[model samples]
Target: MACMEEQRAPGHRWPYGPPWRSAPGGAEPGRSGLPWRSTLLLTLFVLVGSRFSAHGQPHRVPLDGSAHALLLLACVPLLWRYRHPVAVPFVTATAALVYLAAGYPYGPVYLAVAVGCLSAVVAGHRRAAWASVGLLWAGHALVALWLYRWLPPAGDKGADLTQEIVIATWVLAVLAVAELARVRREQWARERADRAQAARRRADEERLRIARELHDVLAHSISVINVQAGMGLALLDSDPEQARTALTTIKAASKEALGEVRQVLDTLRAPGAAPRAPAPGLDRLPELVEQAAAAGLTVAVDGEPPRLPPGTDLAAFRIVQEALTNVVRHSGSRHARVHFADGDGMLRLRIDDDGPATGAEAGGSGNGLAGMRERAVALGGTIEAGPRSDGGFRVLAVLPLHTREDE
Candidate 1:
């Protein structure tokens, strides 16, 4: 985050204070890297502009070599503004005050002070920057109000209190400009950080979606294939006809798994492209039942599934699929039950299986339950999975109908 603030914004107007930290590729349009061009231009402008202002204010002391040197001292510190923010403002302010006391004509000599002060403020040294400019103004007010008699260009009368208004305005203008630059630079930084954080959050959500898709697709299909392969091998010679039916189930399960896996991979290949096939929904519950039957488990689905948002429908399908897969893989009883109903804009799902503690004998990564919970939470829903008191495993999910995810 610290490094974030040092980089430059693409097209911010000010050059002294740092803005957005985009790639510093060869000095962007509004951002400067070394600031050498602007520094040189500023110094030259002060020199030339002062020579003209002095001619116009003849009563003031002329621009001699000493006055030129003091002006140079003030402007040169600006080159080191970024590296030495606090020091630069004081150096420039000191020079401005010394030049004023010497009676050099008031002119563009203040521009250097302004730049240094703004740099300090933008660099997060607000107190130091304010104090530096305050010092210069205080010193100038003293000289112009009382010290004029002892100062150079001897026959001078002290300035009236009314004349202080002009000086006050200049100081006010510098402070206002510095404060504005500080605020705008911070705003750019906040916006940049927010954009970066948002990008990361979106990436995390995508990874999760892919994980759930892969897990649900692979877990359920592979479970069926595992059962059929076992059946085929056990009865390969003892009952050749039964073995053939098992092999055919294996073929169909593998082909469907491949298709679904390929569909998932397609999403990775071309994000934001429409899915090649409609996502599986509760309407495919019969297919789920058939696949379970092939695995030697009985699946009975009760109650009609209602029309739902695509996200909700997909979640409902995945949850039911995962539950039935768990039953086929982990339950001793070959019968599983799935019940779903819609009421008051909510969809309720319940899956149950007769069980007698498969425990360590059942092999699974244990991510299915968590995945179901994630799906439910994303749609403002909930999932509860555990054992029933009557020696059965149960998974219950309550999903919302009005859930909306950004397209």
Candidate 2:
């Protein structure tokens, strides 16, 4: 049964086009023996074409030993057909034609003609393939007819016609099969390229998401704490109690923010699949405020903030952080107030500081304010920041806390 299966199995595969791997910085083999495979198949045709030559024919040319040698040897370099399909086929076909013209019997050399036809097809030259097929058919028929007319074997009169038709059909069938395989290989290569491009795009998007998180969470928090610490230090001699409280706030805010940053990094670097909790939102606002107060920015809260969606909560906190940071930097006032309330289906947060407002500083365009505005806009919200005519800077942000349907 194993032997039977082996017999049924197709022969070895031939590499086409170029060798997939080769010594670097050196000349490479062109075709992957596909042309040789075709040559072997064509050698079979030679056997069939030459069978009738033994008949008592008057004009049949005896098979020349040298011509048979050329036919068998021509396939050696033709193995490079894919690497140099056009060049290899041209050389092989020219050699075969010379052999045929030199009175080499058609019997052993028909193999070379068949391989030339296949080389053209595998090279993806439809025009050349068709021409090669037509030329071989005509050559075989002309040679057979030559022998039949002069050296016709006395017993077999009509057999040559059948042999000619059979060889022609076999050549066509081989060409069709080769074309099919080439098309399939091309399709597979295209699909691989498309998948590679999609994977690159996904990687870029993932990096951008991480960047946003690092900027909004870690950078914004650090900025606010730094501002408050500076103000507390400035007043240390006049208000030692306030300075101590500011240092305490700095420590707490730093520790909490560090843990959150680490959690985000751990999830990003996880080796395999692992679930992670959603990011902290407005539910953690009290803790955020406490940390800020510890840093020496006397913070006041009023009007309960509504239960907000996850994204809105994050945006609200970022807005507050940036506003308070600006207060610590420019506001001469010692107190900052944060107010949250719900009105008209939106959650509003306002951070007000008794900061000096001049034409140069009022409605200022800074990175902190810009980042805050970007977060608000991304969530389909709006922010307003300017001098409150009463000599303080105010930042106001409004965001939808529920879906359109819920509203």
Candidate 3:
């Protein structure tokens, strides 16, 4: 989770994070090698340790014949431990109790019960695991106490016995540490999955935003060109020269808008693909203004600019594009002015037009203004747009050109 926070922190790479350690090709949790190996190694360890103990101890009866057969039978369920851990441990524990009751050597059975206790701890509820371990240990202790009554005469072997108990405790502690590692690995896997899901959601939202912008930009532009083309056709017989000029301008504007729309659509079609060209930036403002002019919106630019970061450049370009689009659609304006300047550690833009009164009927209830404001604020800037008290609409933005290094 902490890794997720670091990867998504502000000012880091947007939307996508760096690559993660993926699950191996064609490997899945249940079908992977891990569970099989865990079962196989544990089974071998139990069987070998039992045989070795019987051989080492002269007094202990060798677990052969029917008793040995029963012990082997009890362990068949051990292979199911990873998938049905609680069931395996419960069955094994019952078998261990019966084996000890049948008066066989308890050492091998006791060790099996200990391994089962560890599995139960990991796979069962915390309270149930604690209860199971305590009950098994107490049963083993009682069996040991009962055997003490018939054992050979006592010997002075206190230090040796203490050392053996210490070693056994250390072995159990090591096994518990191994279980802890397994749990932490599972936690990391879950965190990685969650991070991937969040990144996908962010990508979907960004795609939606791009789609919305394309719809507004292209739909509105094409609709205007259609209307202008029809008007030119109707006027051709009466006003041949004016109609011819309008038709030419419409062709040029429609072609340019189509190219821009195609570029945006290509991005939407395959986000992972490399772009054919960089997105429009402030350097392309002249081309954008020329297209708007061809659409019959007279536009003038007045001012100089400073070198800017790419992000700022894109934001500036989009702002102008959206503002000019609004003028053509709602302003009924014959002329528009765009002013840009950089000073006092800030870049300022002002767009205004002398046009007719565009009321609520014209669909100019600040949707474009709000979109422009959102764009500016995302890059640490501000915008204000409304009817300019001077009988025109004004869209103005003040953006920071300098900030702290951390920004």
- TM-scores for all candidates: the values are 0.90, 0.59, 0.75
**lDDT of each prediction vs. the true structure?**
0.85, 0.62, 0.63
How many residue pairs clash (N, CA or C atoms closer than 3 angstroms) in each of the candidate models, in the order given?
4, 17, 0
| Per-residue lDDT over 210-294 for candidate 1, one digit per residue giving the tens place of the 0 to 100 score | 8999899999999998899989999998999999999999999989989998998887777667789999888888999999999
Error of 3 at 258 (Å): 2.5
Task: Write candidate 3's Cα lDDT for 1-407 as tens digits.
Answer: 12222254567442232222113232224364434555566566666777777676655445767666657655766655555656666677667655654455536565555555565555433344445445544454555555434443232112244544654575457457546744654566566677787767666656655754675566446645764776699889999987887788788767867877887777667655766867667787787677676667788999965777766676777778877877877777879999998888789999899867554243433456666777788678998887877788888988777644326
Sorted on TM-score, best first, the list reads: 1, 3, 2
lDDT of 2 at 336: 88
Question: Against the hidden true structure, what lDDT does model 3 obtain?
Answer: 0.63
Clash pairs (backbone) in predicted model 3: none
Better of 1 and 3 by lDDT: 1
Q: Please give the lDDT score for candidate 2.
A: 0.62
Query: Which scores better on TM-score, 1 or 3?
Result: 1
Model 1 stretches astray by more than 4 angstroms: 1-33, 405-407
